[model samples]
Target: MSGSISRRDVIQAGAAVTITAAMVSGLAERAVAGPAIIPFSVSVPETALRDLMRRLAAVRWPEAETEKGWSQGVPLHQLQRLVDYWRTSYDWRRFESQINAFSQFRTEIDGLSIHFLHVRSRHENALPIVLTHGWPGSVIEFLKVIGPLTDPTAHDGRAEDAFHVIVPSMPGYGFSDKPSAPGWNIERIARAWTELVYRLGYVRWVAQGGDLGAFVTNTLALQKPSGLIAIHLNLALAIPSPLPTEGATLAEREAITAMARHGTDGSGYFQEQATRPQTIGYSLADSPVGLAAWIYEKFQAWTDNTGAPESALTRDEMLNDITLYWLTNTAASAARLYRENNGHGPNQGVVAFPVGISIFPREIVRVPRSWADKVYPNIIHWNELNKGGHFAAFEQPAIFTQELRDCFRGVRRT
Candidate 1:
């Protein structure tokens, strides 16, 4: 097959494949003959680093909000402090080293060069899972869990619990190529992911995602692609068809209240990005502090923090993600995803495949089981986490890893 072969081409060819070292070597040879799975390493240019620092030094400050606390948005004092730390203390090389420590690669799927971290387990019969990250988040969210997931034995877990993990940067995010056309919506991303897994030669696999990643994973389950056995989601997008009446239960009332608050106060960025990504993109692309504050505001609001985002994520951790967007200059392109997929939600009725959901208390909307059951009928596993919030993997990696291990225990192929 040629490098331009579609995923359908590979699936139609239908060859049984395993992930042994020898098999990987054979696959590498085939990659050269067909579409090349090139080994990828990240090296940010010194010129870019200098430019980022220059922009940071020359940031134009905005006036403080009239409100006392976060009722308005990220405070000026807090943002200045964070910006100072990011400029002086945050180390981009350290973050780059952490990512490059893993086995990373880029391969063309659906006419786009997709960047992904492909870490295989040493354990026998390890389950394969594709992890998708959301907006204001990159593969950085999964860095903490990668070691625990891929090498369970090393992390005080049995080898049988190990997973062959694939964390991909969605199109227009991180190192992945930005889409120039207008057709790259959530469903298109789902198709790309289907092709990605099949192209890697996996016959059976599971998928896990949170936020926008959850949207894509749920779409995958809805599509019922060939190799996808099951799916686990941190953010349940299963909005019931014909919409249920509001205030049915206490939980439902709370969910409605929370969603209402977000829609009113927290959706400014959402609206702008969905309608005029280019307008905001200019600010994000040009100003480093502007980019930092834009993303940092979400970290503050979405996390399980009481007063500040620092209560949940460390300064360095937040900077690592923000720096990725700044260095890659992907702020506008990433924002365009919202425009391409405006008003997209879960399909009505029950998804046929096995679905697992983990609910965090402080998620944008704390979905009730009654509401979720209307859409996800085959919910084999459902857990309400006592702590954590929207960015579950980033805030609580240990709990997130365990959730996946337990949720997929029965779903894994023998």
Candidate 2:
């Protein structure tokens, strides 16, 4: 063979062979000595599909809120329309087929079966980048950007802009195994990412993330793990130590006011998830409509839509994510993450690695550049977008893709 063997080659060769528990044990032994990447696929059982439809059909709706609009959470009429479509017209298999078209697998990392999509570029010397998703979002968030990122030439860009992309479902969020005990916080997640990249045989790589993904990426930069060249974050959770208020600009003042408003009015879900995820989990796991309403509220609040979620994301796109949570029975496990890392603040670390930031207009807390500079000392690139919101990749994939291509051009390794 003239070409060097890549990790994908080993996975492709073993794709057909099924590994039993005993074989997995043997692989575990081998893993201690070297990398143990496995090939995997997604196949929801027929029974599960029937069950989801049945549940959607038999929903016991709550009465409409006295107040109009989203001030009181997702309106009853909006949710009903969404549910009707989900039960009558939405297609889960199509979403499954879309994701399954890409290469996916589960590998044991720190005793958990972590699921990820690994797509390699055909172009030689492509930069490897790992993308992580956040709460209420799954690997589906990056589905739209994967092709454009991995094969830029096919998507109206230069081959040099190509990237070998890896999108991982955060533990307990999607197909990834839920943590049995309690120690899987942001820091631990970052360490597992480091191991995951190394196991995939990348000597040099970069990372990008938003929401909870941003927290993980920020931690990775702070840890300064070996082989990580740089990182880019859409949600900058930068808080100055001891808090400074001596000199503030108009934007800074506005950002502070927004932060206060979020703390007061928009943190009910945060407080509940942080304190009592199990309680809400019961309602989430049993009632499909309940789960839809819970998540749908965030879609309305976070996106740049003009008071209507459909303005930003289609009903199909929203259902695709809601269905992932429903099928995986991950509603509770996912929420418990908030409890696991309660009181966790993103402003403590001092990162020395090069950092790039793309600030969307409607992000939860619009941290001013002055605030971000306090934590990320070596800022290489920073841009403020006119549109987009919390779910940048899911909501504005083209803009998100272009942002990454432009942001990483300076930091790309040879």
Candidate 3:
């Protein structure tokens, strides 16, 4: 519990295992194994990044009329600010070094290069916490919280609360390898993660994730490995059950309506990525602006930030993520994950695991608490927050951390 992730936890990152797995829903108990040190890397090349910046500066964007806000795409003014900073001010090497500084590495899992940051706490009582990131978000979302989660004592917390954080780039999202074959659904990733934590030598641990990471964590929770005491997720409503036949509460009725509406608009990316990720990936791979537009739009729409995306995060911070995609040329590979996972991945069953869910206001987690409680029979924590939207980590790390600490409080075992 005190050390960073154990070297043995690395599996010889799997080769693309065929057979697309349905989203795992049925509840089952599983075993957690430490991964063998499957060699992995998160480093980006120097020349590729420089060329990406040059391409961004010379991008020929179609200007929109004043009437058209950011509805269709990012405005020229906004893109210029980001691109200008990317060309002159943003430093990819610095960000790369910063991310790698805290024990970053990759392991081939299911034939994909899974990039992850394993930060161990110096405290004797550190809890092993696995943090997963969602779609349109790389490991950057957890960057601010890594310090707080790994060294809570330095951040004015008790040593008992320290976390040996494992932050992985979802397959195809960052430094992780893109899936070449079918399958590689969220549940498989969860299974891979179950092995991942056990390999670290922790007898019992907790997991937390938001967005796609949330879905992955949800599957991990559903698996309910022997060492998995509990799982916490920012977006916790994925498994859809029969709607409440028992008359709906005001909140539940409203939530039902929201879920219906979300299917219409909130899920555009899922459709494109699930079906035609290669097309979108090719476009994004060739054009840096396209990649920014695809990923940046989510930052604006999903975040609770105002003024500009820059207001919530420095342009450099945002570009650092986009730069990773541009340099790695993994945009297409990243999109292919959607093809592999589909909607909510494989919807297998009703899990009775001890799951805790925290819903931020501006998210698709409109499923009422009653609905959530039915699937997670052992839910012990539920929170409704006002500050952040989808990328809660970046929007409100302090709040997110506190909520996570509270969710898994008294649940870890060394």
TM-scores for all candidates?
0.91, 0.91, 0.85
Q: Tell me the whole-model lDDT of each prediction, alpha carbons only.
A: 0.83, 0.84, 0.71
**Which ranges in model 2 have alpha carbons more than 4 Å from their true place?**
1-35, 241-246
Error of 1 at 147 (Å): 0.8
Q: Say which candidate scores most in lDDT.
A: 2
Q: Locate the minimum summed-lDDT window of 10 residues in model 2.
A: 20-29
Per-residue lDDT tens digits of candidate 3, residues 3-53? 111223322343322221111112232433423444443445444556676
Q: Model 2, residue 2: what's the lDDT?
A: 18
> Which pairs of residues have clashing backbones in candidate 1?
none
Quick one: how many clashes does candidate 1 have?
Answer: 0
Query: 1 or 2: which has the higher lDDT?
Result: 2
Sorting all predicted structures by lDDT, with the top scorer first, yields 2, 1, 3
Predicted candidate 1 versus true structure: per-residue lDDT over 227-336, tens digit per residue: 68889999887655444575478887787777778879999998999999999998888888888889999999899998899999999999999988877778999999
Question: In candidate 1, which residue ranges exceed 4 Å CA deviation?
Answer: 1-34, 241-247, 346-349
In candidate 3, position 19 carries an lDDT of: 20
